[model samples]
Target: MFNKTPFKGTSRTSSGYSYDDDQFASKVFGEIARKDWQDYRNTFMPVHEIFKTAVMSDDLTKQQLDRIPGNIDAQFKQSQAQASAINERMGLSNLNTGRTDISKGLAQVFAENSARTHGKERKMSAIAGANISPQDARVNQ
Candidate 1:
């Protein structure tokens, strides 16, 4: 947003705008007209750029541009629906921290069961390695 401001007590230079001439300063109306001309000149480049783009765009390009707005609208709606489903499944992002407690409980149960199984296997291996028949062990006892 370019704005036109006059050279006051403290002067600011606008590009291509020269310092106020004593002669020009004496003529307030001329200075106003000069500023107006500069403002109009500044507007030219942007307008020309837009005009060039409009001229170069074909019907296909125009259709693509038109589709962008609609596509954005549809994608936003789909994403919102997806977010709702995810929130419901996860018990709401803000309210639920995680299932850490359940995971830890299951891990403890697994460890206990694994230890019992290892102990049973070790005892069975020792008994088998001894090569003692049940009757021989009973006679020894």
Candidate 2:
């Protein structure tokens, strides 16, 4: 049998009971929603922070790598000049050839290292530029 209880905004059951089912349900659901939101926020914030830290670390690494080629080039030039001077003073043409070969070897090594570092820099830059967020992944899904 349907109870003809008045549906007032107050917490009262249909059987004239003083129990507030509406308020209790609302409070429970509100607490659940708040807790869910808090959980989502807690999970997402750390992922965002980690992403930012990774991007910053990669940027720093790229900067350090970029300086390496210049430093190597400068050092090579200094060493080449000193070697050429020494060879001229010694009047040793064979020493000049050996120096040239060493220079070529070092140049090749530097070029390979520079290329690899540039690849890493590009990869890191792409990752940083993407600026992806955890929430974005969830939304896209």
Candidate 3:
């Protein structure tokens, strides 16, 4: 008498019989039809003809591909110039706000204290930018 056991490991049960039935399934449903292949081949066009038609009919210019490197370099240089201009403006704004000055002072103070306490003065970090702000980011007095 084969008792119904989930695993094949020999663990003694009260009625003691391991019923390990066929624990797997087969996937093959076997036999291909010749007409199916003929119909599939009939519906398809060759790659060379496809390419020929695509290139001839399309409005894509050859000069565009040739100019790719110069275009990319010009775009990147323009973006970098814009970013540098923004940074200079931001730095001047920080000097005007006095926040940058205050941060420098705080960093010095922390460094001095850390040095006095542990015999090594080292600067860690300063609060540079905000992570979160109100949706409008407006302060109404």
> Best TM-score goes to which candidate?
2
Model 2 gets an lDDT of 0.60
1-141: candidate 3 lDDT, tens digit per residue: 765555566553322222232322211111134556666667654643443343333122223333444555565557557766887988743223445446555655554454343211111111233232222122221
- The candidate scoring highest on lDDT is 2
* Residue-by-residue lDDT tens digits, candidate 1, 1-141: 543345345554434343454444446666688889898879887875554344333432334444554555565557567877888898885333356456545655555555455445544544466442332222112
- The TM-score of predicted model 2 comes to 0.33
**TM-score, prediction 1:** 0.25
**What ordering of candidates by TM-score runs from best to worst?**
2, 1, 3
lDDT of 2 by residue, 1-141 (tens): 654345645445533334445465666667789989999889998986665665444454445455666767787778878887888899866254456557756775776676567546544664667644443223112
Q: Candidate 1: global Cα-lDDT? A: 0.51
TM-score of each: 0.25, 0.33, 0.23
Clashes of each: 0, 0, 0
Candidates in order have lDDT scores of 0.51, 0.60, 0.39
